[model samples]
Target chain A: MSIPAIASTRNDALASLLDNAINNKTKPLGSLGMLETVAKQIGLIQNTRVIALEKPAILVFAADHGVVAEGVSAYPQDVTWQMVENFLARGAAINVFAQQNGCALHIIDAGVNHDFGPRTGLTDRKLAHGTHNFAQQPAMSSDTCATALAAGMALVAELDGNVVGFGEMGIGNTTAAAALMHKLTGIPVAQCVGAGTGLSADGISHKQRVIEAAVALHASATEPLDVLATFGGLEIAMMVGAMLKAAERRMVLLIDGFIVTSALLVAARLQPAILDYCVFAHCSDESGHKKMLDNLGARPLLQLNLRLGEGTGCALALPLLHAAVNFLNQMATFESAQVSEKSE
Target chain B: MSIPAIASTRNDALASLLDNAINNKTKPLGSLGMLETVAKQIGLIQNTRVIALEKPAILVFAADHGVVAEGVSAYPQDVTWQMVENFLARGAAINVFAQQNGCALHIIDAGVNHDFGPRTGLTDRKLAHGTHNFAQQPAMSSDTCATALAAGMALVAELDGNVVGFGEMGIGNTTAAAALMHKLTGIPVAQCVGAGTGLSADGISHKQRVIEAAVALHASATEPLDVLATFGGLEIAMMVGAMLKAAERRMVLLIDGFIVTSALLVAARLQPAILDYCVFAHCSDESGHKKMLDNLGARPLLQLNLRLGEGTGCALALPLLHAAVNFLNQMATFESAQVSEKSE
Candidate 1:
């Protein structure tokens, strides 16, 4: 898929709603802290009383990478497929979070090495059981990239709801995501790679070296999607697609940690339209997330030193999104509540 | 209220369910991280195919203290009421979080020294408008303490929710919380007192001295509640009551911030059963919370350097609780999914 179209926004309406909400609040100007802006934004977007959050949704995508055998990830390649099974079986962290927050969870097999044939539960949208090794060559060809994008858009089309979250599971995906983030954001791969699944200190160094090599191989690519086709796993490509669809649908995109954010960066680079709906779930303890978030100018909802992937960060963020929506919809207005502001 | 009871936990049933769930999953043991135990506990309690989370709630109790006049807080008394208004107007960070997480917010007027009246929208449960200056004399009388407890318990009865959170909005409350925790934990007030609203280095030193003096004033108190009744804010007493009722109802208690945790310490001392239902929402950057958490053997889920209260931590925790229920219900059996798992 080509870049998503940047939709026109009602700046006047959003600005007015923000300005009105702040002025009407009982607190001194800017005293409500981060919440002050959230209320305003919600008020602007929904175009009415921001009340009642409904149909929270979490989207977890899983894929495989050739880099797993290179010792970039702490866990083995089997862990990715194992976690996908866990997610489908509703035993994963994201599954638990989705349940707790009243979110309908949908897990997609974006790509993995093994066939999960005849499985009734898994959303089998695999784009070749894992991609070509980035160490030797591009992860997937251009045709596979288009197929992955289509698969992502398909998932979002089916699950349009109040908020959409993107979570990922892959053993060596961090090396893959960091490489893509570097290609799109112009940050070096070393700055973007992190311990994917509990990598040792030495494992991180090896992962860094692997990422640098991949970046070195793909340095001359001019286009973002081409870079993704070069180093992006099916999960990353699919996440980029899902985010675009969420943007088009005007759904809030709850972005998980490092790998997901790297996907977000790729999606945003391809289509600046996506940034409007994106909320960084957390600044992962992973070293690369900060630079990616800073480059995207994203403000994450949590900073729990969390590096657990599989959309756990995104699942955690589900509550914050509802909070934003609830305040936007609920809360008595200055006139309705009949509360007096300070002397000002 | 009498000391409360914990949920009738079928620990054996829970352990059995966990064994079955993990054995059936497609991953090795402990691959799901903290979520594994969480799922088993949910299965035990709900005893169903689908665990449902409902009645998410937060109690943000606001007040002011004469201690602020002594410059114990970095912000003025006005900010206390101002933040309360922010909470009521859904403009504070906690408000946004509460709204996002589907946690019903109940901001109480425990004693802001400002007349919220019946029309103020905040539930007017004030105890003497505000406490007497704790530095000079006891913050409140024993009768006032009883009244605060009554107010918190009454609110719990009215909200009738599945989960409860306790947070405070008094400007100088942290100083009082620190002094209380110091007395309870037998730690020095200097170690417990923290910067309440960004105190300068000189201001922190001065605040520590003031807390030391207050602790000295209360050192001879015969009992915990008596000490609290003498020096704690009306809101703190009310939280003890609120927490008691929450535990009695078997609703999960989400403990927030330093001041609120101090109330938990008081309530738990009065009845240890209340401790079983509590989930420490966060460790505030405030100096006291870490010590309080450690004393309780409680590990907080978030550590965002947040000092602003109003049940913000609970609001953030809403999603994790949501996840806990989902995993208990949604995961399928190994036979059904045909997934192979490693034996422990």
Candidate 2:
């Protein structure tokens, strides 16, 4: 399976132009702080001073995780499909936030165990019923992982947007993400594991043990794709594909919390330049997420302590993106506003 | 001067109901993080489980400070009126953000040194040409201070909104805010002073010295009103009145950076219950802002390193307020979505 090439958005000339435009705005230099950085990033990604976020979309991929059989998650595996139904019915947090922020929501079934026939808002892209239990064996065959990635890429290719936010609903997938994070980033399984969906102390310990055993079993899978195939959920693999494709298309990629960032870890390893098009939405309340973000040298836009992940962080953070771009495009320069600059 | 009585929004029965409503939403309990707190706060403020934020408006009080002559700020005092003109022209940061976030922007002339005979969209409420230089004397007389406070209260009384965000534009206002912070919080003058619009180290030291001398001269003014009269800018005094009035009316007061928060400090001192009505927008990059927020025992929603004082922080954070309310109202319950709860 061939990964699309993402070009480096490192244009010194364009960077200078963006800086000039941002600095001349009718406020103190760097007083806008992180917003100036965001505006510059968006400008760089678009390769233009006039940045436009057109047809912003959030694709929430849902699937089941075989890791659920190990009692790693607080909720049953059925909650995955139930939450997807909630998304379709417009009753989920992601649905409400996406609607509030004017982003179109697309719910995709990557590899859920249940079969829903001909649903209106649900996009069918299932690679299988679910991955095999990684605690006992590899999650998916190499071909299946490739197929999931390709499907994700194809979905973005057909979408009508220059920006896409990645979200996921997969019961027990945090276990999968933890395992993937451990293998890919060389972090200990214990450090990668967390109280996913409200696990108790003992439950978290047991979850860590389960992931440790899985990581030890899949120790030979050192390459990015091999590590992903061994431990990644179908939804995660697909998100990896979607993120890569979005970056390759020069669309701004809004990345949510742990599970989504785990996919990004894989995508970034495959093509490092994809980081240029990516925006780390928030540092979630989920344990090890900050470390995961730190590992990638990412500074997230918000740290709202959000742990519920149907790309809710991404949806919440979309406004900051708009604010960043709006300030860049609409704010007056010191010259334009006739405001005095800093004292010489 | 009559300060409006602010009733505490503390109802145990209603708090229980708001918690039940929030926890029953289709997400993990406390997963929404600060947003959950904001939702509950709004619910309690409105005295109902069904929370609604209507006709949100950002009132930007623009003024000029006499303290600018003491070399306490980086920009000239005239920039205050210029930025206000920028706001009126819809080309300021606050205007751009407020417009993008569906917030009505109100530009009020609290005490700018300049004057336009008649301008559309500019609310004229000048207390004086500007405050008297606090370094040499009191910023305002007891009567003038009282009048400023009354003017702020009267302005909010006529505004048609359940939510009001406070922003300000005044050169050298941060110097005034630092003085207010020093006096109200008993924090050291050096700790409270910072780079207001790009002050150098020497400039910050000079600002600190100016504030320290002024603070010493006003040492006898221990009462909040007397302290405000001694140190606060007209915009800050007006904001104090506006904040108290807004709280008395139970409007969600979205408080901006250091200067706006200084106004809140005075408001909270006079009516301690007013803190309950405030939504601290962001912990600005402006030095001493974090300390000021800490002094109020307030946890702000966003910390984007924004130091611009045009209520840009308030406008930027408005979407999160909407999201918090939206999620509370729209999301499904565990039973409603048929999503399984945590395993026993």
Candidate 3:
């Protein structure tokens, strides 16, 4: 399968208009700082001087990765399914943040091992229940990778908002994300690996070795999807597909953490245009996230050291998106407020 | 009048409980990142594991400084009264952000040169129609400084919230804040001066020169109050008073921008315990703000490069305060979610 076409480019005319509009707002010019940047980016993306985030939603993909068997994660593989249930029950940190920020949440089971079976708010689009252990074999076939990507794209197409945040929950997926980062960026696996789910120093080194061995096995994989099929989790593939679709639909894609960004790296390689639609939510303390963000030249909204991958960063940044839009629309201009501008 | 004593120390016992509670959240340990730090700080401040921000108010003090006559700021001093009027009309950035975050805003006429007679939502606490020309003479008499401090203390006493944010509006007050920062932190005047209200490079140098000249004039002023009386704007003096009162009452104080922190430096000096009650809201783009934050060993929640300085930073951060408190109070524990904890 080929990468989907993304044709939208940022509207420079609207961006300049936003700049003038933001500067004329009763405050000092450029005093809104990063908010002015946010306002401009959104205005340019939507191609409008009048911008607002309407019906924002968080799309969270949950799956299992084959690498958990290598003892790369501190939590057991079953915890993935258990946490998905927790998300369904609205009892996780993501749920609390989503509720706090008024963001609608849709959790997807891309390829978790357990059968959730017709749960509300859960999109069951499992890709072969779980991928093949990439340590011994390709994580999934090229066809399965395409299916996962299409599933993600389809899931996003069903969402109601023009702005959406992406997150994922899968034990050992960080190992997959790290491996993908290493393969794509060629940053060593040691720097890419981190203490996912609270691994100790020794555990991290061991996880590093597992990822390194897996990378060696997949030496023949060179294409983006081939690499994804080699080392990516099912959820990551879907997210890569969903991100492209979201960008195609011109939705604001809120990208979260290391796993989400690894998928984003795949999506970016597939279609560099997708970067225009993305807003990094935070810099996770998770290893390699900073490097990934640096590689993309993206500045995230928050830096809260959050490594929880269940779309929590997306939920946290929802209000900030609201502020950016609302400030652009609602803030009184100098003329409107009859306030004096700075004198020369 | 004497400086009010602030007796509140961070509650260590409750902090330990909060640490345990936060660590046991369904998310991985330390995964919540800055949110966990925020939760711990609030829990310690309130001396309770269960915390809530009730009746959060942004106390915005607006006054004029005599320093504007020296051409030390980018905007004319009349803009101070104009902005206060804008605040009352809900046409300012502070008003928009305050409304967005549901923070009750109390705009004070600390010493604006204009008479905004009998306005609702405007607290009339004039401090002698702004300060004297500090470049030529002491900005305020010691007697006026005492009255300003007492008024700020009285105003906080009348307010209904246990959580409050401090903000100020005064043209040329950045010069005053820079001068105050120079005096308190002993940093050079040039480093503390910046493009306040859109000053050009020449303007900043001129402002720096004006500040240096004033600091030289007040070389004999040694005590904090003496320094405040010598160089502080009425709003700064009042904020110092209000901050001390807020700390004495054990209310959480959200400190904003350069001018507000300059006032807080005075307050903290008067009573070191006041630092225990304060939360740095954002690192303002104002030149001296980072130094001021560093002087206090504070880590501000946001770094949006905002320099608008009307408690706007406080308002932007109000939702985050809510997130921190609500997440602590509302997120299901690992036990409640029945999710397995990270195995040792």
- Quick one: best lDDT, which candidate? 2
* lDDT by residue for model 1 (B1-344), tens: 34445555456755675667655543333444444554454444445434566788788888888787788765567767766766766666676666655667777888888876575557888777788887888888777787778778888887756777887788778778877887788887678877666676788889889878876776676487887876688788888898888777766778887888999889877877666677777777777788899998877776555555777777776666665555545655545555443211
In model 2, pairs of residues that clash are none
> Taking the tens digit of each residue's C-alpha lDDT, what string does model 1 give over A85-136?
7676666556666666577887788888877786766788987889888888
Q: Judging by lDDT, tell me the better candidate of 2 and 3.
A: 2
| Candidate rank order under TM-score | 2, 3, 1
User: What proportion of the real contacts between chains A and B does each prediction keep?
Assistant: 0.16, 0.90, 0.77
Instruction: Judging by lDDT, tell me the better candidate of 1 and 3.
Output: 3
What TM-score do all the candidates reach, one by one?
Answer: 0.74, 0.99, 0.98
Q: What overall lDDT, based on C-alpha atoms, would model 3 receive against the true structure?
A: 0.88
* C-alpha lDDT of candidate 1 relative to the true structure: 0.72
lDDT of each residue in A1-344, candidate 2, tens digit only: 69999999999999999999999999899989898999999999999989989999999999888889999988888888888888999999999999999999999999999998889999999889999999899999999999999999999999998889999999998898988888878888778988889999999999999988877787789899999999999999999999999999999999999999999999999999999998999999999899899999999999899999999999999999998999999999989888888875
Best by DockQ: 2
Give the DockQ-based CAPRI class for model 3: medium
Which of candidates 2 and 3 is the stronger one according to DockQ?
A: 2
C-alpha RMSD over true interface residues, each candidate: 5.6, 0.9, 1.1
lDDT of 1 at B55: 80
